[model samples]
Target chain A: MSISARNVFKGKVTELKEGPINAEVEITTSGGDKIVAMLTEGSVKSLGLGMGADAIAVVKTPWVTLLAGTPQYRFSARNMLHGTVSSFVKGAVNCQVNIMLPGGSPISAMVTNAAVADMNLTEGTPVVALFKASHVLVGVPV
Target chain B: MSISARNVFKGKVTELKEGPINAEVEITTSGGDKIVAMLTEGSVKSLGLGMGADAIAVVKTPWVTLLAGTPQYRFSARNMLHGTVSSFVKGAVNCQVNIMLPGGSPISAMVTNAAVADMNLTEGTPVVALFKASHVLVGVPV
Candidate 1:
């Protein structure tokens, strides 16, 4: 089914657990899907969501976006990667774009010299990084 | 530096996004690290986070856990997968594990039948999967 048709659940904030600012929200859908939403602590506060507050969540098919260059698969909007330019590693043909999120972790995305020059990206510049959620594979311990 | 010592930033949730029954929190740590936290929507509401509320986030080193009989690799706790018991393909004997994560997704370790049997895993029985944050390898798009 399309993602939009999936049930939307409203839950409450139970606990802000460990692991460097993580928020957990409990949601129960009409189909009895009891689920949780793991959010950055910052995201929780920004929404004014706190313990015992009601938050709405929906379960839909994965979101996907296609880019022109390569045949890379995209997931949904929920799984996109967004960050800011932290640093750049100069290379012979390409430059490594280091994007930092508000969480203090850094991600490096490679960009062509032409692209870099076109964007005029530098340290401290804000940029939106996008990727499909499916690109993010999930696994559990055996 | 430790993830705990990193400065945590908060952001406001402008919108309510939906995904599958099991939703993963896609977050950008303040230090520019893109990480996912696997949880249900119920978990998000329990934490009292919502649209426009402040969220505290931190960049942390990935969490890594080792499983027996497989190449040791890292797993990202944020990215959780759910699937049915497909079939016992190959690799180790005595284990009937299914690939719950999306097809073509990168996997650090494979689940075995012995492990499922030990867990009393059956077809259609929902399992609470677990992984570490450290296993997520971040790279720039080439």
Candidate 2:
């Protein structure tokens, strides 16, 4: 089936930490980008996930949060990628921003037109993308 | 500022979408699931999003899709959460399905009676909840 999520990264499981209620899985993409996912203990067991496992991390675009400037406050989210704005597209209410990570990974984000103007963002601008570990969905190939 | 999204979970940017006019974002919730949103490029810039930024991803309940049984096909939606039916309330046209994620977080989905019956969903039945990145709304704390 055609999935609605826009980002799919195939990676290897580098670490697995299990808790009573949840579990955290770390995936290292071929592009050298690291993705961390938090799921349920049951999911971890059901998927039979372990270190060195080949897994796929899936993320949808709208859930990506954009940040500018140096982050003054530390965030609880696990993933933080720094890159420069490579391109963008404007729309009636929202727009798409493309950022190229230093590791050669391409990331995208959707924001409002008003926020774009407020931040005065443009191509070549430095930015950050944030994602919480729990938002990541990990699946093994069937 | 307050928004219309009924589901608001604080997380960071995990994935993003690049589109002609709009973009998709994927956010990992603290409770160990991801949410996707579609917005304009302008909104992304205005919010100053980067990886690791403390942001809140929001989704309206109606935007959530529910699926039962094991997924035989791949879906494009960014957020696919596997959980159990905690509770539900039926209405004339739409019914709400409350799913309990592994981390003790609750996710609510609005589906049709036909779908519930078709899926044979019950209080303890396992199900998958889906969200497209475009349907998610990303925001940074002011």
Candidate 3:
């Protein structure tokens, strides 16, 4: 099947934490990077998620926000990654920023052009990429 | 290293079509779903990408747009997928909509609650998910 969803991660399930309403599942990629996904508890059980099972985690790019300079403020976001700016695609309204993570995997973020100036982003600038766990979607490979 | 890039697809490059400044790469996932990514020709050469090369494509979720009901409009977006609205999570400002594609993979989209209400989305609603090829970030497995 062809999918319009741009982000797709495949890994083995390492942990599954189920709650009354939501659940957090961690999948470790072959490269050893970990991805955490937050989805509905009903969906979690319905997918029969368990440790060692193969799974995929998907998150939209707009939900990802980049923090340049020092991320002086702290929030409850489950994923916070620090990396150097690898590339920049400045668009008319929204700017696409790519940060090269430690493992060589790059994370992309879409922000307004105004924010780009405010952050003074360019190649080699250090930034933190963050997104909420609830924005992640977990699906099993059939 | 730990990172926040939520979407990661491990696949082998099945086809490579190079253009003047940009290139389109086709990757086939383990489940046989093919994904197309558009990136700079510089990146293409730098990554030494060729047919049968292993690569990873990262796309921000926000790059994904969900269109409820039959999409009768024409757009330049390269990727358009049709799926059923498998799940919905209504939020204060935006709602997270998950569309289950034909191969049992679900894609997540973040849309304003106003848009959700405007579209009258419900379970089993058929919709088209669209995204641009330029919005995709292609990376080599590290």
Candidate 4:
């Protein structure tokens, strides 16, 4: 179907965890980055998710957050990918920063222009992209 | 900088419309797709937004909604794109569905597995992805 969401990664199911209300599945993208997705227990069973299953991790760009500098404190986010500022798209209210991960995978982040200025996210700035596992959607090939 | 968002689109501001409380800015991606973003009026001015400025549109996956069949009723969403189902990764509660746009752009979406079966979204299923412009996060490159 047609949608505006980008950031789709084809991955493989490396592990699966089932719970009462929700379940989590870990998928390793083709680029070697692992993504975790949480869904309902019924979905896990109906999807026949198992080890070594091919899957696609669906992450929206907005759900992906960008950080300018590294802090010593720990956060609750489950996913963190490191990369350099690849590009910048300035908008009236927000700016889009592209963080190029180690395998040449570029993760895009949207932040306010004020935040961009406050963080000084320019080209080549080292930053981290963070997102919650629940924000990740995993899809298997038909 | 290092917050919890990813998926950034760097584009040029082709249009800007300011309302009483909120404002809408349209950015054309390098690939030529124009994405509309809505933010507060203060954000628009504080960012020094104007015509033909560079900007970014940040959108989270939860802000995205996927639909398989075409409906007769009109909706209030600001953006909608049509594509074909490229794949589906099922989870316990939700399924990640990837739709391949016309330009080979893949847009990912999250839906329940029951919705998947209800919509019958297999590979190659025609569907439409919809989202409101207000859900988009706007930013400028600092």
Q: For candidate 1, what is the lDDT?
A: 0.39
Per-model TM values vs. the true structure: 0.27, 0.54, 0.52, 0.53
TM-score of chain A of each: 0.43, 0.91, 0.89, 0.89
lDDT by residue (A1-142, candidate 4, tens digit) is: 3323455566678888887746788888677777777754555776678889876666666678777665876768888888899887665665667687786566776567798888887889899888987666555554
Best by TM-score: 2
Candidate number with greatest DockQ: 1
DockQ of 4: 0.05
- Tens digits of lDDT, candidate 3, B60-125: 555676665443333334556677888887654446788876755566676545456777778898
| Per-chain TM-score, chain A, candidate 1 | 0.43
Ranking by lDDT: 2, 4, 3, 1
Where does candidate 3 stray beyond 4 Å? B1-142
Clashes of each: 99, 62, 9, 42
Fnat of candidate 3 is 0.04
Regions of candidate 1 where Cα sits further than 4 Å from its true position: A1-77, B1-142
Best by lDDT: 2
Query: How much is A4 displaced in model 4, in angstroms?
Result: 2.5
Candidate 1 lDDT tens digits, A36-115 = 55555544555565555554443221111212233355544433435577776564555556665455444455456676
lDDT per residue for candidate 3 within A1-142, as digits (tens), equals: 3233334456788998987755788877676667787755555777788899887665555768888775589979988777889877665666667787776556777678899899899999999889876566565665
Q: Between candidates 2 and 3, which one is better according to lDDT?
A: 2
* Local accuracy by lDDT, each model: 0.39, 0.72, 0.69, 0.70
lDDT by residue (B33-57, candidate 1, tens digit) is 3334444556565664454444443
